[model samples]
Target: MPSQDEILAVILGGGRGSRLYPLTKMRSKPAVPMAGKYRLIDIPISNCINSEIFRIAILTQFNSVSLHRHIYRNYHFDNFHTGWVQIWAAEQTMQNADWYQGTADAVRKQLFEIIATRAKYVLILAGDHLYRMDYAAMARFHWEHNADITVAVQPVSKDEAHRFGILKRNPNFQLTEFAEKPHDPHLLEELVSRDDPQKPYLGSMGIYLFRTDVLVDLLNNYPLDDFGSHVIPQAITTHTVYGYDFTGYWEDIGTIRSFYETNLALTRPNPPFDFFDASAPIYGGTRFLPCSTVYDSKMKNVLLAEGCCIDHADIQDSIIGLRSQIASGVKIDKSIIMGADYYARTDQVDIGPIPMGIGQNCQIEGAIIDKNACIGKGVIIRSFPRGTDLDFDNWVVRDGIVVVPKSSILLDGTFIGPGSKD
Candidate 1:
């Protein structure tokens, strides 16, 4: 039983997330924790669920164990008879090589499953971003225009515009040109209508709505490879690829700095992303825990999730993850602590300290520490997590990010510094 106008959505979650290094060293980018509470993939899934699209298949590869576990534990929906949210991992039986090479190839290999569903449109979206959108409305717009492909576009600043897949559209909303990370904005404006392009140049959100047969044929007979590299560029001239104007909050968390900034953006008094929307609620796995408690702590502008304990610590502009514990007199500012075992573990690879500290009396200066560090009392640790100058005289300077492996235990009274020994 299928509706004639139903569209299938495919969430692309196969990137190696190398830019989010250290953090992504163990977990996939989509599964990485965000705002100290939700995973990166939750944003898109919540959007899809809120949009009332029940049939979804998350395509994952490359360090997908954590991502798979996260979806299974939190977002599996079994209520709808025809709605099935499935996960498609790269299988050796289907491909002679490793995991998916690119976004287009990821879907092309599994085009059969999508075709079998008999959906009219196939929606492809990226899972590594922070945004709240009504995809259902976007889908309706696609049908309203009878477009071969409808891409979500938003306005970006001139300096940052070059980093995105900039779109050029006419008054009729048809895309005339598509360029990936172009250097010149004026040149990009050439593709736009003469009227007003620079003031509001369209940038692709990587959220595409493709006609089922069109997508199938493109995957079958298209001479090119990836979507951005081949598909969209080729389709612009031959097909009616319209640009759907979307004026919502969209942040691409491609690098560590961007990811950190996006998380901090949520701590604002009124965040752009309202996860509690009543009409389109972002669904998450149920957690049974009491809300966080702060006692004698000087905390400001921080987001504390349930099952957390903060005691006598100075915290500002930081995101505390689920069930994490911050000990008394421990001061943390401009840092991200994903796990809570920092104060109890003893096993660590110490090189030198630009900034590292521990113990009840330890005073830590400004710097980053990864996670799962054990510091004994009365030690001063700063942001410089590793000291590498001693080994090669070329210190592994702290990128202002302290990364500790998961569940690392620290012994009391141990002094470590800015770099890593391991």
Candidate 2:
């Protein structure tokens, strides 16, 4: 097995996440809060720490202020240890006067720094994925196979295969062909594993392990910008590329619908991804807040974070984030409420009728309330009967879930439901 010191992990934080919309309005996609207490970037970073691969660099562009702060504040290595996590934001220099064109381009620009580390292998990962992976196992697989490049693949349903870059591997798991988002049924069938025709096709998980020399050569010779679109296909023809099959829980939380559904799934009795696994635990910043206090509230299947106050409310199948304030007579169901940044002081002046958190008599269902939002009293946020494809004043309905943007304020008695207009 290769030592962790010989591998440098680079997490690619993609460009502005337009799909996440209002959530990405103030913060980068990776920096966006997930599962109430942890941010999206924490998943991959935690995985690396668990796998004992600590030397890392996060390549980010687009609204990186919060992302930088979160990483710096949360991750701190011991003075004696050489392991460290650093952010390498995009910059315009004389050599490269442009932003990252794609994933491949981003890494290519940082090749100098990566090579300086003198690592034998490079592990490239996506910043927005939610999963737990032991990268050491993957590294061993790459070394045993003597592969120039090893791509981590997962079996996805035929219905979902069209959303990913598909690949066909031989009996030895050597990648033969690669196609990005193939729609043709004939092509899809060819991509399916020969072992079981009924089994789902092997789709790329966007996790890559590359030999240092091979990676450097490919980046320098190829002018391609993206790995999925340009680099991988080209590498398959000339270099030895193998597939590492991974059968685990993985979700790319790139869109609002996926993000909303993933968080809600955690509220289930048996969540696909377990955060309480002692063997491999997810790490997040420790905010020493008071324990949540509930008063005469009926709650079930809820993951309430620290510093929350619930009073005479009925909350079911929901995730209440840190420092969430819920008043009396409020009923919340099947929703994700990302709580406030800080507690409202007694001397704080009320900007409107409602203060900071959910007001009294407010009924919310099938919605995602962003951080620091002020929802006034008697406000009803529910799906539209006609269909949820409309944009209201402070929120937008997507995938039948009303999403209240960050720091938005809804006035008193605001009712949003089916057929809601601008």
Candidate 3:
């Protein structure tokens, strides 16, 4: 634990991740299940462990108790004297400000707790991304440049540059300009001279390295502005901010489409990202159970986590979460079900409403059934169930979204209506 150590890690896990909607409705984004088993929080936590950076803190709020419990049970290492990976939840007190305002302000408020442990530099990372990165190398790049702030940059298409922070960097990799979603002159859009290999611009990965003292000072007067919207761009005029180009398997699984698409990724032959690679495995906390069992079920190219029970069903291109149960004669296709339980019991017996269940002989075609919902047998739930195009009170969705509410029951052979899915 020397003063000259290259890095410390801060995981920004406080956001509600509302974009993920029903997935995040009950759990924080970091706690959302990924590729069948791993929670979103496990990504950065595992990355830090595998990359040889042990001391880290997860800053969490908004349904964080579950996220906290998962981290406590799963993230473990045996050989560290001064290194520990843990969490930092908001503590409402008499003097300090309450709750996190934003990502930057969250760190700004927790300076004492972070500094209490004597970390030299703070590496800020997000909790919702899915990628395998050697952050140790990225940190080394930061130290070599003596950068006041170092941002991980990647080359992105001009159309996609609007989706992220765009940076204009000089030949030396010194960032010249940063735009938080520019209208035109996209990041990395300019053509490089035929003789030069460097691209036009670099897009920020929303990952950054900040010198401890410099970060504290800058955040102190940061005026409640975010790193992307204000701190990064403003710092470019004076502070030494550099870009580190990164090329790897990285995706922000923050939206429903992205989540579904990512699940569909595993089905590809020799996919770009493989979770089962034992050598470079993305370590998540192992559930205390044997591998998932499939009985009388037809499964193809799906990712099923431990503790799952599948019986007499056809599941394909889906991500089933931990401890989930798929009953007989059901078909779940191209869906993402996160460790949700579908039992036949609940407290909604008054109006005959009950807990969730997707029953046998049911066709849940390209639809989402939220947690705790009970769908009866022989039911057809879909935006276009049979393509019958029948004239019988036909249901037409606004965004063509269909959802089965949590803790509700659809009677046998019932047809549920649709609206914006998320």
Taking all chains together, each candidate's TM-score versus the true structure is 0.85, 0.97, 0.85
Model 3 ranges off by over 4 Å: 1-6, 185-200, 341-357, 369-373, 383-411, 417-422
Tell me which of candidates 2 and 3 scores higher on TM-score: 2
Ranking by lDDT: 2, 1, 3
How accurate locally is residue 207 in candidate 1, as Cα lDDT from 0 to 100? 90
Which parts of model 2 have CA positions greater than 4 angstroms off? 350-353, 385-387
RMSD of each: 5.0, 1.4, 4.9
lDDT by residue (242-356, candidate 1, tens digit) is 9898888889888766776677667778877776678776665577777788899787877776777777888787776765666667776666666442233235555333212
Clashes per model (N, Cα, C within 3 A)? 40, 2, 9
Error at 394, model 2, angstroms: 1.3
Residues 1-422 of candidate 3 have per-residue lDDT tens digits of 22324468899995877566656766788887677667788888777777777788898888887788888887766764666778888778676657887888888878887788677789899998888888878777877888899999887665565687888778787888767776654324442211334434467888988888888888886585477787888788869999887888789887756765776686666766777666567877665666778898888867777767777999876666666666688887765555554333445565354224456777665555555555667777665433322222222221233444334466777865443222
lDDT of 3: 0.70
Alpha-carbon shift of residue 145 in model 3 (angstroms): 1.3
Residue 242's lDDT within candidate 3 is 91
Looking at model 2, residue 64 earns an lDDT score of: 91
**Candidate 2, residue 246: CA error in Å?**
0.6
Who wins the lDDT comparison?
A: 2
